[model samples]
Target: MGAEVLADKVYCYPFQKVVTGYLNKYPTPLEKNVTAVTTVEEQTDPATGIVYRRRIATCNNIIPSFLRKSREWIFKWSILKVTNIYLEEESWLDMKARVMNLKCRCLTWAQYASMNEESVYRESKHNSNWTEFSQKGTITITGAGYLNCILERFAQTFLKQGARKSIAIMEKILEEKYGSPVS
Candidate 1:
Protein backbone atom coordinates (compact mmCIF):
# COMPACT_ATOMS: atom_id res chain seq x y z
CA MET A 1 0.00 0.00 0.00
CA GLY A 2 0.98 3.62 -0.33
CA ALA A 3 0.12 7.01 1.12
CA GLU A 4 0.66 10.52 -0.17
CA VAL A 5 0.79 13.84 1.69
CA LEU A 6 0.93 17.36 0.30
CA ALA A 7 1.51 20.81 1.79
CA ASP A 8 1.72 24.37 0.49
CA LYS A 9 2.71 27.64 2.08
CA VAL A 10 3.82 31.15 1.25
CA TYR A 11 6.52 33.23 2.83
CA CYS A 12 6.46 37.00 3.04
CA TYR A 13 10.15 37.12 2.26
CA PRO A 14 11.53 37.50 -1.23
CA PHE A 15 12.44 34.44 -3.27
CA GLN A 16 16.13 34.94 -2.72
CA LYS A 17 15.75 35.19 1.03
CA VAL A 18 13.49 32.16 1.15
CA VAL A 19 15.90 30.07 -0.86
CA THR A 20 18.82 31.14 1.28
CA GLY A 21 16.92 30.31 4.42
CA TYR A 22 16.07 26.87 3.10
CA LEU A 23 19.70 26.03 2.41
CA ASN A 24 20.64 27.07 5.93
CA LYS A 25 17.57 25.57 7.61
CA TYR A 26 19.20 22.37 8.76
CA PRO A 27 21.20 23.96 11.53
CA THR A 28 18.13 25.64 12.96
CA PRO A 29 16.22 24.65 16.09
CA LEU A 30 13.28 23.40 14.04
CA GLU A 31 15.12 20.37 12.71
CA LYS A 32 16.18 18.51 15.79
CA ASN A 33 15.69 15.12 14.20
CA VAL A 34 18.39 15.73 11.68
CA THR A 35 21.78 14.79 13.03
CA ALA A 36 24.16 15.53 10.20
CA VAL A 37 24.20 16.60 6.58
CA THR A 38 27.01 15.73 4.19
CA THR A 39 27.39 17.01 0.68
CA VAL A 40 27.91 14.00 -1.51
CA GLU A 41 28.07 15.78 -4.84
CA GLU A 42 27.57 19.22 -6.31
CA GLN A 43 27.99 20.88 -9.69
CA THR A 44 26.91 23.83 -11.74
CA ASP A 45 25.88 23.99 -15.40
CA PRO A 46 28.27 26.52 -16.88
CA ALA A 47 25.97 27.22 -19.81
CA THR A 48 22.58 27.36 -18.08
CA GLY A 49 23.94 28.50 -14.75
CA ILE A 50 21.71 25.98 -13.02
CA VAL A 51 23.16 24.72 -9.75
CA TYR A 52 22.82 21.05 -8.73
CA ARG A 53 23.59 19.64 -5.30
CA ARG A 54 23.29 16.25 -3.67
CA ARG A 55 23.47 15.62 0.04
CA ILE A 56 23.08 12.74 2.43
CA ALA A 57 21.35 13.53 5.70
CA THR A 58 21.19 11.34 8.74
CA CYS A 59 18.23 11.48 11.13
CA ASN A 60 16.91 9.65 14.11
CA ASN A 61 14.10 7.17 13.54
CA ILE A 62 11.03 7.71 15.67
CA ILE A 63 9.50 4.31 15.41
CA PRO A 64 6.52 3.37 17.54
CA SER A 65 6.91 1.12 20.55
CA PHE A 66 5.38 -1.92 18.85
CA LEU A 67 7.87 -1.52 16.06
CA ARG A 68 10.67 -0.90 18.52
CA LYS A 69 11.16 -4.61 19.07
CA SER A 70 12.53 -4.87 15.58
CA ARG A 71 14.20 -1.49 15.65
CA GLU A 72 17.59 -2.96 15.00
CA TRP A 73 16.19 -4.97 12.13
CA ILE A 74 14.19 -1.99 11.02
CA PHE A 75 16.51 1.00 10.75
CA LYS A 76 19.54 2.02 12.69
CA TRP A 77 19.94 5.39 11.04
CA SER A 78 17.54 7.06 8.65
CA ILE A 79 19.66 8.22 5.76
CA LEU A 80 18.11 10.26 3.01
CA LYS A 81 19.60 11.38 -0.27
CA VAL A 82 18.51 14.90 -1.09
CA THR A 83 18.93 16.45 -4.52
CA ASN A 84 18.42 20.13 -5.19
CA ILE A 85 18.42 22.10 -8.41
CA TYR A 86 18.35 25.86 -8.43
CA LEU A 87 17.28 27.95 -11.41
CA GLU A 88 18.90 31.24 -10.64
CA GLU A 89 17.33 33.17 -13.47
CA GLU A 90 13.81 32.04 -12.66
CA SER A 91 14.30 32.31 -8.91
CA TRP A 92 13.12 28.73 -8.56
CA LEU A 93 14.37 25.76 -6.59
CA ASP A 94 13.36 22.12 -6.81
CA MET A 95 14.31 19.54 -4.25
CA LYS A 96 13.75 15.80 -4.22
CA ALA A 97 14.70 13.32 -1.57
CA ARG A 98 14.37 9.58 -1.08
CA VAL A 99 14.97 7.11 1.73
CA MET A 100 15.87 3.49 1.12
CA ASN A 101 16.79 0.76 3.56
CA LEU A 102 19.37 -0.89 1.33
CA LYS A 103 22.13 1.29 2.73
CA CYS A 104 21.70 -0.39 6.10
CA ARG A 105 21.91 -4.14 5.75
CA CYS A 106 20.55 -4.72 9.22
CA LEU A 107 17.27 -3.16 8.11
CA THR A 108 16.67 -5.76 5.41
CA TRP A 109 13.01 -6.12 6.31
CA ALA A 110 12.47 -2.46 5.58
CA GLN A 111 13.63 -2.90 2.01
CA TYR A 112 10.02 -3.07 0.93
CA ALA A 113 9.27 0.31 2.39
CA SER A 114 10.45 3.49 0.73
CA MET A 115 9.64 7.15 1.07
CA ASN A 116 10.00 10.01 -1.40
CA GLU A 117 9.48 13.74 -1.04
CA GLU A 118 9.55 16.61 -3.50
CA SER A 119 9.35 20.33 -2.86
CA VAL A 120 9.40 23.42 -5.03
CA TYR A 121 10.00 27.01 -4.07
CA ARG A 122 9.59 29.97 -6.33
CA GLU A 123 8.76 33.66 -6.43
CA SER A 124 5.04 34.30 -6.27
CA LYS A 125 3.43 35.05 -9.60
CA HIS A 126 1.35 37.82 -8.11
CA ASN A 127 3.95 39.50 -5.90
CA SER A 128 7.70 39.62 -6.11
CA ASN A 129 7.99 40.07 -2.36
CA TRP A 130 6.34 36.71 -1.71
CA THR A 131 7.64 33.21 -2.16
CA GLU A 132 5.50 30.16 -2.79
CA PHE A 133 6.45 26.76 -1.51
CA SER A 134 4.82 23.40 -2.11
CA GLN A 135 5.73 19.92 -1.04
CA LYS A 136 4.54 16.42 -2.01
CA GLY A 137 5.46 13.22 -0.28
CA THR A 138 4.74 9.55 -0.84
CA ILE A 139 5.33 6.44 1.22
CA THR A 140 5.15 2.98 -0.32
CA ILE A 141 5.08 -0.34 1.46
CA THR A 142 4.79 -3.57 -0.48
CA GLY A 143 5.53 -7.11 0.49
CA ALA A 144 3.73 -10.43 0.57
CA GLY A 145 5.00 -11.22 4.02
CA TYR A 146 2.59 -10.86 6.94
CA LEU A 147 5.07 -8.90 8.97
CA ASN A 148 5.47 -6.46 6.15
CA CYS A 149 1.75 -5.74 6.08
CA ILE A 150 1.66 -5.00 9.80
CA LEU A 151 4.67 -2.79 9.51
CA GLU A 152 3.12 -0.92 6.63
CA ARG A 153 0.14 0.14 8.70
CA PHE A 154 2.39 1.47 11.43
CA ALA A 155 4.66 3.13 8.94
CA GLN A 156 1.80 5.01 7.34
CA THR A 157 0.82 6.55 10.65
CA PHE A 158 4.40 7.27 11.57
CA LEU A 159 5.12 9.04 8.30
CA LYS A 160 1.95 11.12 8.45
CA GLN A 161 2.75 12.35 11.94
CA GLY A 162 6.33 13.10 11.02
CA ALA A 163 5.29 15.10 7.99
CA ARG A 164 2.88 17.26 9.92
CA LYS A 165 5.34 17.94 12.70
CA SER A 166 8.09 18.80 10.26
CA ILE A 167 5.86 21.20 8.34
CA ALA A 168 4.75 22.99 11.49
CA ILE A 169 8.34 23.36 12.57
CA MET A 170 9.35 24.70 9.18
CA GLU A 171 6.56 27.25 9.13
CA LYS A 172 7.49 28.43 12.60
CA ILE A 173 11.10 28.79 11.59
CA LEU A 174 10.22 30.70 8.45
CA GLU A 175 7.99 33.04 10.37
CA GLU A 176 10.74 33.72 12.85
CA LYS A 177 13.36 34.35 10.20
CA TYR A 178 11.29 36.30 7.68
CA GLY A 179 8.42 37.60 9.77
CA SER A 180 4.80 36.55 9.39
CA PRO A 181 3.71 35.31 5.96
CA VAL A 182 1.45 37.43 3.83
CA SER A 183 -2.10 36.26 4.27
Candidate 2:
Protein backbone atom coordinates (compact mmCIF):
# COMPACT_ATOMS: atom_id res chain seq x y z
CA MET A 1 0.00 0.00 0.00
CA GLY A 2 1.16 3.55 -0.73
CA ALA A 3 2.31 5.69 2.22
CA GLU A 4 -0.32 7.85 3.95
CA VAL A 5 -0.56 11.59 3.29
CA LEU A 6 -0.19 14.15 6.06
CA ALA A 7 -2.96 16.69 5.44
CA ASP A 8 -2.94 16.03 1.70
CA LYS A 9 0.78 16.38 1.13
CA VAL A 10 2.58 15.72 -2.15
CA TYR A 11 5.08 13.35 -0.54
CA CYS A 12 3.87 9.76 0.09
CA TYR A 13 5.00 9.94 3.76
CA PRO A 14 5.68 13.38 5.15
CA PHE A 15 8.80 13.70 7.28
CA GLN A 16 8.61 13.90 11.09
CA LYS A 17 9.30 17.64 10.82
CA VAL A 18 6.22 18.10 8.63
CA VAL A 19 3.97 16.03 10.91
CA THR A 20 5.24 17.80 14.04
CA GLY A 21 4.72 21.15 12.41
CA TYR A 22 1.14 20.30 11.61
CA LEU A 23 0.51 19.06 15.17
CA ASN A 24 2.06 22.24 16.58
CA LYS A 25 -0.53 24.30 14.71
CA TYR A 26 -3.41 22.74 16.63
CA PRO A 27 -1.49 22.68 19.94
CA THR A 28 -4.33 21.08 21.88
CA PRO A 29 -6.98 18.60 20.74
CA LEU A 30 -10.36 18.45 22.35
CA GLU A 31 -11.74 15.43 24.19
CA LYS A 32 -15.52 15.22 24.55
CA ASN A 33 -16.62 13.22 27.60
CA VAL A 34 -19.75 14.21 29.51
CA THR A 35 -22.81 12.75 31.34
CA ALA A 36 -26.13 14.21 32.45
CA VAL A 37 -29.71 13.40 33.56
CA THR A 38 -32.65 15.29 32.00
CA THR A 39 -36.42 15.60 32.43
CA VAL A 40 -39.15 16.82 30.02
CA GLU A 41 -42.43 18.74 30.47
CA GLU A 42 -45.47 19.53 28.36
CA GLN A 43 -47.71 22.63 28.43
CA THR A 44 -50.77 24.08 26.69
CA ASP A 45 -51.17 27.75 25.73
CA PRO A 46 -53.92 29.32 23.61
CA ALA A 47 -52.03 32.58 23.14
CA THR A 48 -49.28 30.85 21.19
CA GLY A 49 -49.37 28.63 18.04
CA ILE A 50 -50.86 25.21 18.81
CA VAL A 51 -52.81 24.15 21.90
CA TYR A 52 -50.15 21.74 23.13
CA ARG A 53 -46.39 21.95 23.16
CA ARG A 54 -43.37 20.32 24.82
CA ARG A 55 -40.68 22.10 26.73
CA ILE A 56 -37.13 21.07 27.60
CA ALA A 57 -35.29 22.17 30.74
CA THR A 58 -31.62 21.75 31.54
CA CYS A 59 -29.20 22.10 34.49
CA ASN A 60 -25.48 22.80 33.99
CA ASN A 61 -23.87 23.30 37.38
CA ILE A 62 -21.59 20.38 38.21
CA ILE A 63 -18.24 20.74 39.94
CA PRO A 64 -15.49 18.93 38.07
CA SER A 65 -12.36 17.43 39.70
CA PHE A 66 -9.94 17.02 36.85
CA LEU A 67 -6.90 18.55 35.14
CA ARG A 68 -6.77 20.63 31.98
CA LYS A 69 -3.90 20.93 29.53
CA SER A 70 -3.51 24.01 27.27
CA ARG A 71 -7.13 24.87 28.14
CA GLU A 72 -8.18 22.71 25.22
CA TRP A 73 -7.57 19.11 26.35
CA ILE A 74 -9.08 17.92 29.61
CA PHE A 75 -8.14 14.89 31.71
CA LYS A 76 -10.75 13.91 34.24
CA TRP A 77 -9.93 11.55 37.09
CA SER A 78 -13.12 11.81 39.11
CA ILE A 79 -16.59 13.35 38.99
CA LEU A 80 -17.67 15.71 41.78
CA LYS A 81 -21.21 15.95 43.12
CA VAL A 82 -23.33 19.09 43.13
CA THR A 83 -24.94 19.36 46.58
CA ASN A 84 -27.49 21.83 45.24
CA ILE A 85 -29.69 20.80 42.31
CA TYR A 86 -32.29 23.14 40.84
CA LEU A 87 -34.27 23.45 37.61
CA GLU A 88 -36.33 26.24 36.02
CA GLU A 89 -38.85 26.32 33.15
CA GLU A 90 -39.72 29.73 31.73
CA SER A 91 -41.77 29.34 28.50
CA TRP A 92 -43.01 26.37 26.49
CA LEU A 93 -40.34 26.70 23.80
CA ASP A 94 -37.62 27.43 26.35
CA MET A 95 -38.60 24.33 28.33
CA LYS A 96 -38.45 22.11 25.28
CA ALA A 97 -34.99 23.35 24.33
CA ARG A 98 -33.78 23.23 27.95
CA VAL A 99 -34.65 19.59 28.43
CA MET A 100 -32.52 18.54 25.47
CA ASN A 101 -29.68 20.83 26.68
CA LEU A 102 -29.12 18.72 29.80
CA LYS A 103 -25.60 17.35 29.45
CA CYS A 104 -22.74 16.30 31.76
CA ARG A 105 -19.59 18.00 30.55
CA CYS A 106 -17.36 16.71 33.34
CA LEU A 107 -17.11 14.17 36.14
CA THR A 108 -18.23 15.14 39.63
CA TRP A 109 -17.57 13.73 43.10
CA ALA A 110 -21.27 13.29 44.00
CA GLN A 111 -21.41 9.51 43.75
CA TYR A 112 -18.08 8.83 45.45
CA ALA A 113 -18.78 11.39 48.13
CA SER A 114 -22.22 9.90 48.77
CA MET A 115 -20.71 6.43 49.13
CA ASN A 116 -17.97 7.63 51.47
CA GLU A 117 -20.29 9.88 53.44
CA GLU A 118 -22.80 7.08 53.95
CA SER A 119 -20.21 4.56 55.16
CA VAL A 120 -18.54 6.92 57.66
CA TYR A 121 -21.63 7.79 59.73
CA ARG A 122 -24.94 6.09 59.12
CA GLU A 123 -28.41 6.23 60.74
CA SER A 124 -31.09 3.60 60.60
CA LYS A 125 -34.80 3.12 61.18
CA HIS A 126 -34.18 0.96 64.25
CA ASN A 127 -31.27 2.20 66.39
CA SER A 128 -30.31 5.80 67.23
CA ASN A 129 -26.59 6.05 67.93
CA TRP A 130 -24.22 8.70 66.48
CA THR A 131 -20.41 8.83 66.32
CA GLU A 132 -17.89 11.56 65.44
CA PHE A 133 -14.36 11.12 64.17
CA SER A 134 -11.67 12.74 62.02
CA GLN A 135 -9.63 10.97 59.38
CA LYS A 136 -8.51 12.87 56.27
CA GLY A 137 -10.76 15.69 57.44
CA THR A 138 -13.06 16.59 60.29
CA ILE A 139 -16.38 14.67 60.18
CA THR A 140 -19.26 15.30 62.54
CA ILE A 141 -22.16 12.84 62.36
CA THR A 142 -25.51 13.99 63.59
CA GLY A 143 -27.25 12.88 66.79
CA ALA A 144 -28.43 9.36 67.70
CA GLY A 145 -29.09 6.69 65.03
CA TYR A 146 -26.32 7.76 62.67
CA LEU A 147 -24.17 4.62 62.49
CA ASN A 148 -26.71 2.90 60.28
CA CYS A 149 -26.65 5.82 57.92
CA ILE A 150 -22.88 5.65 57.49
CA LEU A 151 -22.85 1.92 56.80
CA GLU A 152 -25.51 2.35 54.14
CA ARG A 153 -23.84 5.34 52.55
CA PHE A 154 -20.10 4.69 52.24
CA ALA A 155 -17.71 1.99 51.04
CA GLN A 156 -14.33 1.22 52.61
CA THR A 157 -11.19 1.75 50.54
CA PHE A 158 -8.24 1.04 52.79
CA LEU A 159 -4.66 0.31 51.76
CA LYS A 160 -3.22 -1.30 54.88
CA GLN A 161 -3.99 -4.91 55.77
CA GLY A 162 -4.58 -4.28 59.48
CA ALA A 163 -7.01 -1.47 58.76
CA ARG A 164 -9.00 -3.66 56.40
CA LYS A 165 -9.03 -6.47 58.95
CA SER A 166 -10.27 -4.18 61.70
CA ILE A 167 -13.01 -2.78 59.45
CA ALA A 168 -14.04 -6.33 58.49
CA ILE A 169 -14.37 -7.35 62.15
CA MET A 170 -16.45 -4.28 62.95
CA GLU A 171 -18.56 -4.84 59.85
CA LYS A 172 -19.22 -8.42 60.87
CA ILE A 173 -20.50 -7.34 64.27
CA LEU A 174 -22.71 -4.70 62.67
CA GLU A 175 -24.06 -7.21 60.17
CA GLU A 176 -24.85 -9.74 62.91
CA LYS A 177 -26.66 -7.27 65.12
CA TYR A 178 -28.33 -5.10 62.51
CA GLY A 179 -28.91 -7.89 59.97
CA SER A 180 -28.92 -5.21 57.27
CA PRO A 181 -27.91 -6.32 53.79
CA VAL A 182 -24.63 -5.05 52.29
CA SER A 183 -25.02 -2.96 49.17
Candidate 3:
Protein backbone atom coordinates (compact mmCIF):
# COMPACT_ATOMS: atom_id res chain seq x y z
CA MET A 1 0.00 0.00 0.00
CA GLY A 2 1.12 3.55 -0.70
CA ALA A 3 1.75 6.08 2.04
CA GLU A 4 -1.29 7.93 3.33
CA VAL A 5 -2.57 10.75 1.09
CA LEU A 6 -3.19 13.78 3.25
CA ALA A 7 -5.70 16.42 2.19
CA ASP A 8 -4.22 19.65 0.82
CA LYS A 9 -7.00 21.09 -1.33
CA VAL A 10 -9.99 23.18 -0.28
CA TYR A 11 -13.33 24.11 -1.82
CA CYS A 12 -15.87 26.93 -1.52
CA TYR A 13 -19.63 26.53 -1.24
CA PRO A 14 -22.50 28.82 -2.08
CA PHE A 15 -24.85 30.53 0.34
CA GLN A 16 -28.05 28.82 1.29
CA LYS A 17 -31.22 30.17 2.85
CA VAL A 18 -33.55 27.89 4.83
CA VAL A 19 -37.25 28.36 5.39
CA THR A 20 -36.33 29.77 8.83
CA GLY A 21 -35.29 32.95 6.93
CA TYR A 22 -31.62 32.79 7.75
CA LEU A 23 -28.94 32.62 5.06
CA ASN A 24 -25.51 31.09 5.54
CA LYS A 25 -22.68 29.64 3.53
CA TYR A 26 -22.59 25.85 3.91
CA PRO A 27 -19.77 24.79 6.19
CA THR A 28 -17.37 22.07 5.11
CA PRO A 29 -18.64 18.66 6.22
CA LEU A 30 -15.18 17.56 7.38
CA GLU A 31 -15.08 20.31 10.01
CA LYS A 32 -16.95 18.17 12.52
CA ASN A 33 -15.80 14.73 11.35
CA VAL A 34 -12.12 15.30 11.09
CA THR A 35 -11.27 11.61 11.29
CA ALA A 36 -14.11 10.28 9.15
CA VAL A 37 -12.75 7.94 6.53
CA THR A 38 -14.02 7.82 3.01
CA THR A 39 -11.64 4.93 2.20
CA VAL A 40 -10.98 1.82 4.33
CA GLU A 41 -9.00 -1.37 4.02
CA GLU A 42 -8.37 -4.61 5.91
CA GLN A 43 -4.99 -6.06 6.85
CA THR A 44 -3.59 -8.49 9.44
CA ASP A 45 -0.17 -8.50 11.03
CA PRO A 46 1.14 -11.63 12.80
CA ALA A 47 3.76 -9.68 14.79
CA THR A 48 1.15 -7.69 16.69
CA GLY A 49 -1.75 -10.10 16.30
CA ILE A 50 -3.90 -7.15 15.29
CA VAL A 51 -5.24 -5.63 12.09
CA TYR A 52 -3.45 -2.68 10.51
CA ARG A 53 -5.54 -0.49 8.24
CA ARG A 54 -5.73 3.03 6.89
CA ARG A 55 -8.57 5.44 6.14
CA ILE A 56 -9.08 8.56 3.99
CA ALA A 57 -11.56 11.30 4.74
CA THR A 58 -13.45 12.79 1.78
CA CYS A 59 -15.97 15.14 3.30
CA ASN A 60 -15.30 18.72 2.11
CA ASN A 61 -16.79 21.98 0.86
CA ILE A 62 -19.17 22.11 -2.12
CA ILE A 63 -17.86 24.00 -5.13
CA PRO A 64 -20.40 26.07 -7.01
CA SER A 65 -19.00 25.01 -10.39
CA PHE A 66 -20.28 21.49 -9.73
CA LEU A 67 -23.13 22.28 -7.35
CA ARG A 68 -26.36 20.33 -7.14
CA LYS A 69 -29.25 20.74 -4.77
CA SER A 70 -29.61 17.02 -4.03
CA ARG A 71 -25.97 15.99 -4.15
CA GLU A 72 -22.90 17.59 -2.55
CA TRP A 73 -20.26 18.42 -5.16
CA ILE A 74 -16.60 18.52 -4.23
CA PHE A 75 -13.79 19.83 -6.38
CA LYS A 76 -10.38 18.22 -6.23
CA TRP A 77 -7.40 20.58 -6.37
CA SER A 78 -3.66 19.95 -6.67
CA ILE A 79 -1.60 21.35 -3.82
CA LEU A 80 2.13 21.59 -3.21
CA LYS A 81 2.78 19.20 -0.35
CA VAL A 82 6.08 19.07 1.46
CA THR A 83 6.60 15.48 2.51
CA ASN A 84 8.42 16.47 5.71
CA ILE A 85 6.42 19.17 7.40
CA TYR A 86 9.25 20.04 9.78
CA LEU A 87 12.39 21.64 8.39
CA GLU A 88 15.82 21.78 10.05
CA GLU A 89 17.46 25.20 10.37
CA GLU A 90 20.19 24.45 7.83
CA SER A 91 17.77 22.74 5.52
CA TRP A 92 15.47 25.74 5.64
CA LEU A 93 18.37 28.05 4.84
CA ASP A 94 19.39 25.90 1.88
CA MET A 95 15.80 25.88 0.65
CA LYS A 96 15.63 29.63 1.02
CA ALA A 97 18.79 30.07 -1.03
CA ARG A 98 17.58 27.78 -3.79
CA VAL A 99 14.14 29.44 -3.85
CA MET A 100 15.73 32.90 -4.00
CA ASN A 101 17.80 31.89 -7.00
CA LEU A 102 14.81 30.37 -8.72
CA LYS A 103 12.67 33.44 -8.05
CA CYS A 104 15.43 35.64 -9.45
CA ARG A 105 15.51 33.75 -12.73
CA CYS A 106 11.75 33.59 -12.90
CA LEU A 107 11.45 37.31 -12.32
CA THR A 108 14.12 38.02 -14.90
CA TRP A 109 12.47 35.82 -17.50
CA ALA A 110 9.00 37.08 -16.59
CA GLN A 111 9.89 40.71 -17.23
CA TYR A 112 10.62 40.11 -20.93
CA ALA A 113 7.79 37.60 -21.17
CA SER A 114 5.20 40.01 -19.77
CA MET A 115 5.72 42.65 -22.44
CA ASN A 116 3.65 43.01 -25.59
CA GLU A 117 6.32 42.79 -28.27
CA GLU A 118 4.25 44.92 -30.65
CA SER A 119 4.39 47.94 -28.34
CA VAL A 120 7.58 47.30 -26.36
CA TYR A 121 10.52 49.74 -26.46
CA ARG A 122 13.68 47.91 -25.36
CA GLU A 123 15.24 44.80 -23.90
CA SER A 124 16.58 46.85 -20.98
CA LYS A 125 12.98 47.51 -20.03
CA HIS A 126 12.61 43.78 -20.06
CA ASN A 127 15.71 43.48 -17.86
CA SER A 128 14.84 46.27 -15.44
CA ASN A 129 14.58 45.34 -11.75
CA TRP A 130 11.49 47.25 -10.62
CA THR A 131 9.16 46.69 -13.60
CA GLU A 132 5.96 44.90 -12.63
CA PHE A 133 3.19 43.24 -14.62
CA SER A 134 -0.26 41.96 -13.83
CA GLN A 135 -0.21 38.29 -13.02
CA LYS A 136 -3.54 37.84 -14.77
CA GLY A 137 -2.18 39.27 -18.01
CA THR A 138 1.23 37.64 -17.87
CA ILE A 139 1.84 33.95 -18.32
CA THR A 140 2.20 32.11 -15.03
CA ILE A 141 5.91 31.81 -14.32
CA THR A 142 7.04 28.24 -13.71
CA GLY A 143 9.58 27.20 -11.07
CA ALA A 144 13.25 26.47 -11.74
CA GLY A 145 12.94 22.72 -12.06
CA TYR A 146 10.56 22.93 -15.01
CA LEU A 147 12.52 25.79 -16.51
CA ASN A 148 15.73 23.79 -16.27
CA CYS A 149 14.06 20.84 -17.89
CA ILE A 150 12.98 23.03 -20.79
CA LEU A 151 16.40 24.67 -21.13
CA GLU A 152 18.22 21.36 -21.04
CA ARG A 153 15.94 19.83 -23.61
CA PHE A 154 16.34 22.77 -25.98
CA ALA A 155 19.91 23.74 -25.15
CA GLN A 156 21.15 22.78 -28.60
CA THR A 157 18.79 25.25 -30.29
CA PHE A 158 19.87 28.10 -27.99
CA LEU A 159 23.51 27.30 -27.29
CA LYS A 160 24.62 25.55 -30.48
CA GLN A 161 24.65 28.84 -32.44
CA GLY A 162 27.49 30.12 -30.20
CA ALA A 163 27.29 32.69 -27.38
CA ARG A 164 28.98 35.66 -29.11
CA LYS A 165 26.72 35.49 -32.17
CA SER A 166 23.66 35.16 -29.91
CA ILE A 167 24.75 38.20 -27.92
CA ALA A 168 25.14 40.24 -31.11
CA ILE A 169 21.70 39.20 -32.33
CA MET A 170 20.18 40.11 -28.96
CA GLU A 171 21.85 43.53 -28.99
CA LYS A 172 20.61 44.16 -32.53
CA ILE A 173 17.08 43.29 -31.47
CA LEU A 174 17.38 45.67 -28.55
CA GLU A 175 18.69 48.47 -30.80
CA GLU A 176 15.77 48.00 -33.18
CA LYS A 177 13.29 48.28 -30.30
CA TYR A 178 14.73 51.33 -28.45
CA GLY A 179 17.09 53.08 -30.95
CA SER A 180 20.90 52.91 -30.75
CA PRO A 181 22.43 53.77 -27.37
CA VAL A 182 24.58 56.90 -26.93
CA SER A 183 28.31 56.43 -27.49
* Per-residue alpha-carbon lDDT of candidate 2 for residues 58-130, written as tens digits (9 for 90 to 100): 3343333332122221213322233433322222222222111111111233332321111121122232232
Candidate topping TM-score: 1
How displaced is residue 62 in candidate 3, in Å?
9.7
In model 3, which residue pairs have backbone atoms overlapping below 3 Å?
none
Candidate 3 stretches greater than 4 Å from native: 1-30, 33-36, 62-183
Quickly count the clashes in candidate 2: 35
Candidate 1 backbone collisions, by pair: none
Residue 160 accuracy (lDDT) in model 1: 68
Q: Residue 29 in candidate 1 has what lDDT?
A: 61
Residue 75, candidate 2: alpha-carbon lDDT: 17
Worst 10 residues of 1 by lDDT: 97-106
Residue 175 lDDT (model 3): 45
**How many angstroms is residue 155 displaced in model 1 relative to the true structure, after the best TM-score fit?**
3.1
